[model samples]
Target: MTGARFWDMVCTALYLALYAALYAREIPVPAKRRSVTMSDVAAHAGVSIKTVSNVINNWPYVTEETRQKVVAAIEAVGYRPNHTARSLVTGKTKAVGVLVPDVSNPFFGTAIRACEEALVEDGYSLFLCNTNEDAERERYYLEQLLSRGVDGLILWGARLSCDELEGIVGADTALITVELGEEPRRSNHTCINVDNKGGACMATEHLLREGHRRIGHLAGPLDRITSRQRKQGYEQALVTAGLEPLPEMTVAGHPSVQGGFRAAERLMRTQKPDAIFCYNDLMALGALLAARYLGLRIPHDLALVGFDDIDVSSIVEPPLTTVRIPQAKLGRLTGKVVLERLRGSEGSERVILCPVELRVRGSSGNSFGEEQKKATLDALISSFSDGGERPA
Candidate 1:
C-alpha cells in the first residue's frame, strides 16, 4: 500500500479506538481519565474493556448481563461507529454506486432495480446518482463515490470523456460501464451494451419488408455512441435494398418522448417520409403523436417501428412494433460482473452485447393480420355491450 493509504488506515484505526474510549468513561477523576474511553464504559459496567468491545462489535461472546451494561453505557454516552473510518481500514464499504442518465426512463428504472436486487444478495447496498446526461456531474459523482470507498461502480456514462474514464482505470476501481462503448483508453474498464445497430437494422428491415421505400429516422443525439450506431444501421438497411438513404430524412433528438415529438413533427412538415424508425420507444411514441396530428393513420398512412420494447409499447392505440432488449437481464449480468471483479478476478476488460428481438405489431404493419383479428374481437366485445351477442 502507498504511504498515504497506510496512514489513512492508521488514522481510521485511531478514530475507532478513540470512539470506543469515549463511551467507556467513569465519574470525575478528570486527570486520570484522558477524555472518555471504552475503559470508562467498562468501569461503569464493572467489567473489562474487552467486554465492552465485544458488546460494541456484537461479538456474541459477552454474557447477557455484561451486554446489557455495555448497551446502557453506550446509550448514556451516545457512541456511534464511524463508518467512513472503518471502511478505510478494511478497504470495503459493502456498497456499490450506480450512475445512470435519466432515471425517469422506464428502461433505466428497470435496469436499476435489477442491479439493486442482484447486489442485495451479496449484502451490498446501492447508491444511485442521476447524471442527467452531463459529463461534469458524472465526474463529480465518481469522485465522491470513490472517496467514500464504494466496493464497485456500475457506470452508464454515455457522456463521460476518455480522460475521465482513464482516471477511473488509474484508480484501479472495479467499474462496469453499461450502455456505452469501449473506453478509448488503456483502462481495465469492462462494458455491457445492447445491440443498438443490430436492433435498428432489424427495425428498418421490418419496415422494408412492408415495402416502405422512403423510411425516415428519428435518431438520438449523435454524441451518444448508440445513437450513431443505430443511425448507421438504418442507412445500411436501406442501402442493402438498393435504395440510397436520403440525408434529409433523418432528424436528431434527445432520447425522450418530447424530443421525439418535436423531431418527428419537424420531419413530417418538411420531408413527410412514408415510414419512420425511431431510436427508441419514447421517440417512437412521439412520432406516433406527430403522425396523428398530420391526419395520418398508422401503418395505412405512415408505418413506424421503434427500439426498446418498453412496457407501453404493446398498450398504445396501435401496438408498436419494437426491438425488445433484455434490460433487467443486462442489469443482473452487470452486477455479477462487478461482484466477480471485486472477488479478485483480474480478467481483461470484456464487452457483452445482449441480444434483442423484433416484436411486430400494428405500428409496423402487423406481421400475421393480428391487428385485423384483434379489431374483429374488439367489435364482438362492443356488440355485446350493445346487447347483441351475435354479429349482425
Candidate 2:
C-alpha cells in the first residue's frame, strides 16, 4: 500500500479506538445540540444521501474527490454510525471481545493497543476485559462476551483448559488466542505466539559467544509451557556451545521482579556464574538490583541479558541486552485473523509464529558484531589455555 493509504487507515482506526475505549469505560457520550445524520453530511457535502452512504461504505465506484468531501463533512458534524440498525440488518454486532491477562505488563499493553486500533478500523469495537491470570476469570469473560453478541474474540491468556476452550471453538465464535505455547486442536480457533524458545536460545548463545562459560538462567515456573520452552532453549544453547548442561544453573522464578531478585540472590550465594539470562525484562530488572546489593559490578563482574525488550529495558542502568518481540505486529495479525473468520473468508489460520531479534546493549559488556565476535572468541581461547580472566 502507498504511504498515504497506510496513514489514512491508521488515523481512521485510532479515531474509532478512542470512542470504543470510552464506551467500554462507561463514560457518557456528549450529546450533540442537533442530531447529525447521513442527510446532514450529504447536505453539507452537496451530495445525495446515497452518495454519502457509498463513501461511508467505501464503495469502489465512488470518486476519490467525492469520498474526501463526505469525509470532511463527517468530521465537521461528528456523526457516529447507528451500529444497532446496522447489526439488525447484517446479523453482526460489529464488536469484538478482548481478554488480556495483565494490562500493566508493557508487552500486553502494547499488543492490546495495537489490536484495538486494527479492529476499530474495520468497524469492529472492542469489549476490553482483564483476566488477571485467572483461568476462571478468563472463562467467565469469554462466556459474557459471547452472550453479549460479540462478533469475535481476541484473547491474550491461555489459562483456560482445552475442553473449555474447545467449547467456544465448537460454537464457531471466530476466536484467536495470543502467546499460546501450544496450538489449539480446533478448526475455528487460530493461535499466534512469538518464538519463545528460539529467542531464549539467541539470548543464551549471545552470552556464550561473549566468553562467559559460567552463565546462569533466571527462569519462570516450569509448569508453564512458555517457561519450559525457554529453559529448554537455554540448555540447548549450552550443549551447542560444547558446554555441559549444569542442572544447578537454572533458577526458577514467577516471571516477576521479586521472583528474579530472590532467585538471583540465592544463586549468587551458592552457584557462582559470570553472567545471567532472565526469561523476561521484569525478572532481569530484579536480577540487576540483586547484583548491586551483592556489590558485584555488571559486565565487569556479572553480565546480564533478558527476554522481552519492554519499555524499561532501554532505560535501565547500562541498558539491557534482550530479545525484542514484535508485540504490535502480533496484535495486528490477531485482529486480521479474527476478522477473516467472522466474515467467512478464511478458516483455521492455524499457528502464526512472529519473528524476534536480539538487541545488543551494555549489560552484556560485549556486542555481537562481526569484529566483536572474533575478538571475543580469541579471548575465550586464551582464557581456557592458561586460566586467565576473559576480556569483555
Candidate 3:
C-alpha cells in the first residue's frame, strides 16, 4: 500500500477509536441549547405557528387533526410553552389573589380550600395572603397583589375604605369581598357574607330561652362590621325578650384567645354573668379556659356560646354550642363571583347573605340540669328551610 494511503487509513482508524471511546464513556456532548419554542413544535408537526398557538390556548379555531399532531410533536420534543411570554402577549395573568385576615383560623382555612378548588376547575392559580387582621397589612398586601398583575382579587377583611377600594376596582381587574360588607361607593364589586346580626341574635335568644336572663357578651373590636352587627343583634335579642341591655354585661377586646380570657376574667370579677356569648369560637374557648380556672362548671355555673363553629370547637372538653358559618361555601361563592366578573358580567355588585345556624352541643344548658340540645338541634334544623343538613 502507498504511504499516503496508509496514513489516511491510520487517521480514519484513530478517529473511529476516539469516537468509540467517547461513546463507551457516555460523555454527553454539549447540546445547541435551543429553547423550547412554538415555532419548533409547529415545524415538527408540519403546521403553522398560529395552529400550534391555538392548540396551546385551547382556541376553538383549530381542527382536531391539527391539534392532535401539534400535541404529539410537543410531547415528542418536550416543548413546553413559556406561560410568562404568553401572559405578556395576552395581558392576562390567569391568576387570582385571595387576601384574608387570618389563614390559621379554621373558617379562613376552609374558605381558602374551597376557593382554591373552584379556581382550579377554571384553570386559574391563586395567590393567598394572610393579613393577620391588621388593617395596614391588609392594604399593603392588596396593593402588592394588584401590582403583581393578578386578574382578580378576593378580599376577606374590612380594612379598605370606599375611596381606597375604588382605586382597585376597574374594567380589567375584578374585585370580590368575602365575609365582609359591600363597599358603599363601589356597588359594582361582588360580596359574599353572613348575616352577622341575625346569627348573634339567634345565639343570644337560645340562651334566653334556656332561662338565662343575665347574659353577658364577649364582643370583638367595635370598629369591625361583624363586631358591630353582632353586638346589635345581641342587644336586639335582649330588648325583644324584655331584658334591659346593661353596659356592664358587655366586654370588648380583640378577637383572640387572650382577649377572650381577659374579658371573661374581668366580667367574672365584676358581675358574674349566668351565660356568655363570645364573638368567635377562639374567644369562646378562651372564656371556657378562664371559667375552668375559676373552678366553674360549664352550663351549670356559666353557660357559653360562640360563633364560627370552628373544628376545635367540637373537640373541647365540653363540645362548643356555637353559630355555624358555611365557610367553604362562602369561599366557593367568592371565587364564582370573581370569575363572573372576569368574564365581563356587568350588574350591581352581588351581596350574598349566607344564613347561619346555631350548633347546640353540651356547652349551653338550663339551671334544672336539662341539656338544651334537642331544642337547639330543632331550631338549627328549622332554620335550614332548604332541608340541607347542618355541617357536621
C-alpha lDDT of candidate 3 relative to the true structure: 0.83
**Clash pairs for candidate 2:** none
Candidate of highest TM-score: 3
**Residue lDDT tens for model 3, 86-190:** 889999888999888878777787778878888989878999998888888888887898788899988886576656776755545787876566544454577
102 in model 1: Cα distance from truth in Å?
0.9
Better-scoring candidate (lDDT), 1 or 3? 3
Model 1 misplaced regions, further than 4 Å? 1-82, 183-187, 347-349, 366-392
Clashing residue pairs in candidate 3 (N, C-alpha, C atoms within 3 angstroms) = none
Query: Which of the two, 2 or 3, has more lDDT?
Result: 3
For this target, which candidate reaches the highest lDDT against the unseen true structure?
3
Backbone collision tally, model 3: 0
lDDT order of candidates, top first: 3, 2, 1
Residues forming the 10-long window of minimal summed lDDT in candidate 2: 383-392
Global CA lDDT computed for model 2: 0.81
What C-alpha RMSD separates each model from the true structure?
15.3, 17.1, 9.7
Which stretches in model 2 have alpha-carbon errors above 4 Å? 1-79, 242-244, 366-392
Q: What is the lDDT of residue 282 in candidate 3?
A: 88
Q: Summing lDDT over every window of 10 consecutive residues in candidate 3, give the lowest-scoring window.
A: 366-375
